[model samples]
Target chain A: MENQQQDAEPEDNSWLQSRVAELENNWRTAMADLDNLRKRTVRDTVQVRQQERKRAAKELLTVLDNLDLAIGHAEADPKTIVAGVEAVRAQADLAMSNLGFPRYGDDQGEPFDPQLHEAVSVVPAVGVKPGTVVQVVRPGYGDAENQLRPAAVVVAKAD
Target chain B: MENQQQDAEPEDNSWLQSRVAELENNWRTAMADLDNLRKRTVRDTVQVRQQERKRAAKELLTVLDNLDLAIGHAEADPKTIVAGVEAVRAQADLAMSNLGFPRYGDDQGEPFDPQLHEAVSVVPAVGVKPGTVVQVVRPGYGDAENQLRPAAVVVAKAD
Candidate 1:
C-alpha cells in the first residue's frame, strides 16, 4: 500500500501543477481582456463624440444651404423674399423632424398639460374653453421622454 | 508508512479541490464581467446618440429662433426684411462657429491650396500671381482635421 501510494504521488503532483498552469493562463487572458476593454472604451468615447458632431453638422449644412439660397433670391427679387422664406421655414420644420424633434405647433384647441406646454399668459377668449391651449407662442420640439423645450402658450381664461 | 501516506492524501485532495473551486469562481466572474461590458456598450451607443442629437438640436434651435423673429418682422415691415435677413446671416455664421465650424471666406487674396480651397474656375487678371485665390465663391467651415467643407473659390490663371 505504501509503495503504491508513493508511486501515485508524482503523477498527482504533476497533474495539479498542470491544472494550476491552465488556470493561470485563463486568469491572464481575462486580465488582458479587461485591459483591452478599458482602452477601447476611451477610444470609443472620442470616436463617438466626433462622429455624432459630424452627423449633426451635416444636417445643419442643409439648413445653411437653404438660407444661402433664400438670401440669393432676396438680392435678385425683393418680391420673392417672403415666398422663399416660407419655403425655408417648412424646410426647417422638416429638418428638425428628421433630427428627432418634430414641431408641436398644431396642438391648438387641445387640453393644456403642464408637462408639454408652458402657459405664458392666460387669456380670456370668446367661446373658448378654459384650460385649453388657445395659441402656441413658440412651438416645442421632441417629446416628453426627450424634450428640448416645452411649447410657450396662451391658455383660455377660466370664467 | 502506508497509514501516513493515506492520511496525507485526503488533506492534499481537499486542498486541490478547494483550489479548483477558487479558480472556477474566478473564471466565472471574468466571464460575467465580459458579458456585463458587452451589455453596457450596447446601452452606451443609444445614450450617446440621443445625447449628441439633443446637443445639436439645441444649437440649431437658436438659428431657428432667429429665423422666426426675422420672418415675423418681414410681414410688418417689408423694407426691413433685407436688413433683418443680413443679421440672420451673421447669426447663422456665429451659430456655425459656435458648433466648431468657423466660416472661412476670409481666405481670399491668399495663395490657393488644393487642401483648403477648391478652385471652381481660373481666370487671368493683371498683377495677380498664379495660384492665387481671386474670389471665394462660398465659404467653408471648420479646419482640415474637423472640416465641414472645403472653401469653394476661383483662382488666378496659372501662367
Candidate 2:
C-alpha cells in the first residue's frame, strides 16, 4: 500500500504542474489579445470618422455643383436663377437628410418643446395655444436624440 | 524515511492544487475582460460615426443658410444674385476643406495624374506636354488618400 501511494503521488504532481502551465499560457494569450484589440479600436475609430466625413462631403458636392450651375445661368436669365437657387436649397436639404440629420422644425402651430425648439420671441397669437410654436424663424437639423441645433422659433405668449 | 515522505507528499500536492486554482481564476478574469472590450469597441464605432456625421452636417448648414439669403436677394437686384451665389459656392468649398477633404484638380497646366483627374476627352495642344491637363471639366474633392471622386478633365493627347 505504501509503494502504490508513493508511485501515485509523483504522477498526480506532474498532472497538476501541467495544468498550471496550460492555464498560465492561456492567461497570457488572452492578455495579448486584449492589447491587440485596444490598438485596433483606435485605428478603426479614425477610419470610421474619415469614412463618414467622405460620405457627407460627397453629398454636399452635388449642392455645390448646382450652385455653380445657378451662377452660370445668372447672366442668361435672371428670373430662372431664383428657381435654380431654390432647387439647390432643396438639394442641400436632401443632402442633410441622406446624412441622417434631416431638416426639421418648420412645423407651424405645433406645441413648443424645449428639446426640439428654441423660443427666440414670445407674442400673443390669435387662435393659438400659449407655449405653442407660431413660426419657425430658422429651421433646425437632426433628430431629438442627436440634434445639431434646436429650431429657432417664435412662440405664443402665455396670457 | 517512508513516514516522512508520506507526510511531505500530501503537503506538496495541496500546494500544487492551490496554484492550479489561482491560475484558472486569472485566465477566466482575462477572458471576461477581452469580451467586455470587444463589446465596447462595437458601441464606440457607432458613436464615432454619428459624431463625425453631425460635425459635417453642421458645417453644411451654414452653406444652406447662405443659399437661402442669396435666394431672398434675387428679387432686389438680379446681378447681385450671381455674386451671392458665387460666395456661397466658396463657402461650400471652405466647409469641405474644414471637414478634411479639400477641393483640388483645377490646375490648367499641371501634368495629369489618373489618381486625381479623370480624362473625359483627349485634345491636341501646342507647347504643352502630352498627358497634361488642358482644362478641368469638373473639380474633385478630398485628398489622394481618401478621394471622393477624381476631377473630370480634358487631357492633351499624345501626337
Candidate 3:
C-alpha cells in the first residue's frame, strides 16, 4: 500500500500543475475581456452621442423647413407670415420637448429653488413674498439632475 | 527521508486544495465584475443618450429664440425682417452643421449621385448634362452613412 501511494504522488502533482495552468489561462482571458470591454465602452459612448445629436437635429429640421416657408411667404403678406412664424416657434418647442428637455419656467409665485432657477434680478412687489419667483427672463429645460440650463428669473426681494 | 516525504503528502494535498478554492473564488469575483460592468454599460448608454439629446436641444433653443425675435420684429419693417429671418435661417443651418448634419444638395449642373440626391423630377435642359442635377427642390443633411434625409433634386433627363 505504501509503495502504491508513493507511485501515485507524481500523478497527483502533475494534475495540480495542469489545474493551475488552466485557471491561470482562464483568468488571463477574463482580464483580456475586461480590457476589451472597457475600450468598447468608450467607443460606443462616442457613437451613441453622435447618433443622438443627429436624431435631435433631424427633428429640428421640420421646424427649420417651416421657418423657411414662413420667411418665403413673408414677402407676400407680413400679417400671415407672423402667424406662420408663431406656429413654427410652437413646433420648435414641441421638438425640444420630444427630445426630452421639456421647457420649465413661469413659477410666478412659487418658492425659488437654486437648482432650477438662476436669479438674474430681484424686485420688490407688495403682493409677492420674498424668495419667490416673480418673473422668468428665460425658461429652462429638463430636471434638476439633468438640467440643460437654469431658468433665468427675477425673484421677489425681501422687504 | 522517505518517512518525511510521506508525512508531507497530506500537507501538500491540503495546500493544493486551498489553492484551487482560492482560484475558484477569484474566477467567481471576475465573473461578478463582468456582470456588474454589463449592467453599468446598459445604464450608462441610456444616460449618454439622454445627455446628448439634452445638449442638442439646448443648442436649438437659441435658434428658436432668434426666430421668435425676428417674427416679433416683422410687423415693424417687413423688408428688414426678411433679412433678419434670412440671418436666422443661416443660424439654423449652422446649428445643424454643429450637430453634425451639414446640408447638402444645390449641386446644380453637377453629376447627380443617387446616394445624396433623391431625383424628385426630371427635366430636359439644353446645357445641363444628362444625369446631372439641374435644381434642388429640398436639401439633404449628413453624409451617406449618417444621412438625416436625402436632398430632393431635379435631374436632367438623358437626351
Candidate 4:
C-alpha cells in the first residue's frame, strides 16, 4: 500500500501541472483578445462618424447645386428665380428627411409637449385651448426619440 | 523515507491544483470582458453615426432658414432678391466647410490632376498648357485625403 500511494502521487502532480499550463495559456490569449477588441472599437467609432458625415454632406450637395442654378438664373426672371428657390427649399427638406431627421412642428392647434416643443412665448388667444401650440416660430427636425432640436413654438395662455 | 515522501507529494498536489483553479478563474473573467466589449462596440458605432448625422443636419438647417427668408422677400426688388440668394449661397458654402468638406476646383488655370479633377471633356484652348483645367463644370468637396467627389472639369487638350 505504501508503494502504491507514492506511485499515484507523481501521476496526480503531473496532471495538475499540465492543467495549470493549459489554463494559463488560455488566460493570456483571452487578455490579448480583449486588448485587440478595445483598439478596434476606437477605430470603428471614428469610421462610423466619418461615413455618416459624408452621407449627409452628399445629400446636401444636391441642394447646393439647385441653389446655384437659382442664382445663375436670377438675372433672367424674378418670378422664375422664386420658383427655382421654392423647388430648392423642397429639395432641402427632402435631404433632411433622407438623413433621418424629417422636418416637423408646423402644425397649428396641436397639444403642447415639452419634449418636442419649446415654448418661445405664451400668448393669450381666443378659441385656442391653453397649453396648445398656437404657432410654430421655427420648425424642428427628427422625432421625439431622436430629436435634433425641439420646435420653437408660441403657446396659448390660460384665460 | 516512504512516510516523508507521501507527505511532500500531497503538499505539491494541493499547490498545483490551486494554481490551476486561479488561472481558470482569470481566463473566464477575461473572456467575459471581451464579450462585453464586443457588444458595446456595436452599440457605440450606431450612436456615433446618429450623432454625426445630427451634427451635419443641424448645420444645414441654417441654409434652409435663409432660403425661406429669401423666398419670403422674393417679391421685393429683383436685384435685392438676387443679393439675398447670393447670401444664402455663401451660407450653404460655409455650412459645407464647417462639416469638413469645403468646395474646391474652381481654379481656371490650375494643372489638372486625376485625383482632384474628373475630365468631363478635353477642349482645344489657345495659350493654355495641355492637361490644365480650362473650366470647372462642377466643384468638388473635400480634399484628396478625404474626397467626397472629384471636380468635373473641361481640360485643355494636348496638341
> TM for chain B in all models?
0.83, 0.87, 0.84, 0.88
Best-to-worst order by DockQ is 4, 2, 3, 1
Cα deviation at B76, candidate 2, in Å, is: 3.7
Can you give the DockQ of every candidate in the order shown? 0.37, 0.52, 0.41, 0.52
DockQ of 4: 0.52
Which residue pairs come into collision in candidate 2?
none
Give the per-residue lDDT of model 3 (tens digit) for A1-159: 223334456557556656766787777787788888889999999999988988899888988999889887876876567677788888888898888777888687899999999999998866877899988888888778777788899998866
Q: Rank the candidates by lDDT, best first.
A: 2, 4, 3, 1
Give candidate 2 regions above 4 Å deviation: A1-8, B1-11
What tens digits encode model 4's per-residue C-alpha lDDT throughout B1-159? 223334455656666666877898999999999999988888888888888998999988889999888877876655567888889998898998888899997777999888899999999977998878999999999998889889999999966
Superposed Cα deviation of residue A71, candidate 4 (Å): 1.6
User: How many clashing residue pairs appear in each of the predictions shown?
Assistant: 0, 0, 0, 0
Cα error of candidate 4 at position A79, Å: 2.4
**Cα shift from native, residue A149, model 3 (Å):** 2.0
Per-residue lDDT over A17-121 for candidate 4, one digit per residue giving the tens place of the 0 to 100 score: 678878999999999999988988888887888889999989888899999998778667656787888889999999999989899976679988888999999
lDDT, residue B98, candidate 3: 86
lDDT of 2 by residue, B16-104 (tens): 67777888999999999999999999999999999999889888999999988887787777667878988899999999899887899
**Over the stretch A33-144, how does candidate 1's per-residue lDDT look in tens digits?**
9779878987897788777877777777788888888889879998888788778778877777877988887789998988789999998866878888999999999887
* Model 4 share of native interface contacts: 0.72
Off-target runs (Cα >4 Å) in candidate 1 are A1-10, A124-129, A157-159, B1-17
